[model samples]
Target: MRVRNKPWADDLITENPQAIVLNPEHYRGQWQSRFKSVQPLHVEIGTGKGQFLIGMAVAHPEFNFVGIELQKSVLAAALKQSLPAELPNLQWVLADGQGVNDFFEPREVTQLYLNFSDPWPKTRHEKRRLTYKSFLKSYAEVLGDGGQLQFKTDNRHLFEYSIMSMTSFGLNLTELSLDLHADVAASQGELENIETEYEQKFAAKGQPIYRLVAQFPKK
Candidate 1:
């Protein structure tokens, strides 16, 4: 997913400090202070164009949402889409996902979302996967015991790998769906799903969307 470079990307970030949080490290344990009211924090790592998170913020006002994107232009694009909404509970972060723990205190996050993250399919790049042991460890620390981790992907290999990685990390698999859209269409169960930008495109091609909801094991 190579996004076209936007010349105004830097200006968007610099101009909107309130929406795009530049110094997330300083907020760390006190993330609630950034929002209008103290509430549970839900963060989406690898948030691309911000479609899913924006919908989530609108649908669930009880929770605060933070979207973290590594690319500046992409983050700016997300900002452009999200700014008009003026969601009080939503914010954005421009940083690497690997430093998630550094930006949040232990057990600070209430939930975490990983949607269509890069698979890094090569064997040598396993460590770079979001479900890799080290990343899971950091997620566990931030989410604490019994906190939820919701993941979605169109890649079967990555989905299978994530199941193994998450379970091996002692996270309990609460739910699993091989074809989410099909299930939702058939009304197989009560699943209110929010679609990401990538999801809409991939699903349009008739590809199955894999989704899993897991929770950290209680200490």
Candidate 2:
């Protein structure tokens, strides 16, 4: 999808000094020290409109967050929102999601968030889907052993496909829920605040948002 260029893009670029990693290669194998102290780093791939990534960073001050999006226009919007908040724990990267392993060393990421990622429903486009086996392998390389992947999507087909992919990749899947809100109400401490624009829309429509948490086995 082509992203519409926004006039504010230039301003966003200037405002987000810390968000832009001019030399990501320098931090390789030394990302832990970027935080005040060593803390778990969570990454959200394809963070559209920046709502969820920003909200999570605000909510979880103890954990560092890196949000990656390939579209410059979408990333600009996120950068604008993030700059005003001056969130110390959050950073944004404009890069292909598939290249995550190249940017971080092995076992560097503690958790990953994949919220309402592209369904890529066509069989021919399965490889482009973020939950495809190839992408899972990339995530595994950066994620620590036993690190968790939290995924939520409104598309049932994509959710099912993701579950299959996770299992095929030898991940231990748990906390599967077809309806997140209903499941959350039934189980205390199960609900987290809605962070993404799609999530809010889905909730307004009373849609059943499927969610799952998968953990990589210790190697």
Candidate 3:
């Protein structure tokens, strides 16, 4: 996706103070307090265009959602989609996934969601993968006890790599599926997934979506 420079994107991000955390770093370890409720915090890294995160927020109002997007231009679209909704339980953060630990304290987040993230295919770029051990370790610092990471991707190689990485990090895998949408006929909301834009396109082309759920060690 070619993201042309959109100057207004950043302007909109700053303007939507109620829907976005313009100073996310200042809220480190204070995310729950910001929400003014004790609901579990769930974060979606690489939340492109905010579709998945927004849908989840609408579906699960009891849970607070924080979406992180690295690109301001891309995040601009997400910001546009979110601000109008005025969802009190949801907010957006513009930052790199690598710096997630800097914005949240230990046990600050109860769940992490990675949906159709970039598949850094090159072996030399293994560390760049969101599911890479280095990134998982960073996530562990912010996740609550027994916190779970939910991942979905169309790339088989990345999916397999993620499985291995989770196991190597001593995280326990609780659910595994190679074809996520196959169970749509019998879905009990879990199968009735709220897919991102990329996910819909991939599924439309008959690509199999792989999914996994891994939990961090209990405190």
TM-score of each: 0.97, 0.92, 0.94
What does candidate 2's lDDT look like per residue over 1-219, in tens digits? 777889888777776666765455567677665655578899899898899988888888999988888887888888887887878888777777778888899998999999999899999999999999999999899996898999999999999999999999999996798888887788787567555899889889998889999999997
Model 2 residue runs over 4 Å out of place are 22-26, 188-190
The alpha-carbon lDDT assigned to residue 106 of candidate 1 equals: 94
Residue pairs whose backbone atoms clash in candidate 3: none
lDDT tens digits by residue: candidate 3, 1-219 = 677888788788777777777678999978876675679899999998899999999999999999998888888898898777778888888888778999999888999999998898999988789998889988899995699999999999999999999999899998898888886545766565788899899999999988898999885
Q: What are the Cα lDDT values of the candidates?
A: 0.94, 0.85, 0.87
- Which whole-number lDDT from 0 to 100 does residue 210 have in model 1? 96
Clashing pairs in 2: none
Best by TM-score: 1
- 115-179 per-residue lDDT for model 1 (tens digits): 99999999999999999999999999899998999999999999999999998888899999999
Per model, state how many residue pairs clash: 0, 0, 0
Rank the models by lDDT, top first: 1, 3, 2
Off by more than 4 A, model 1: none
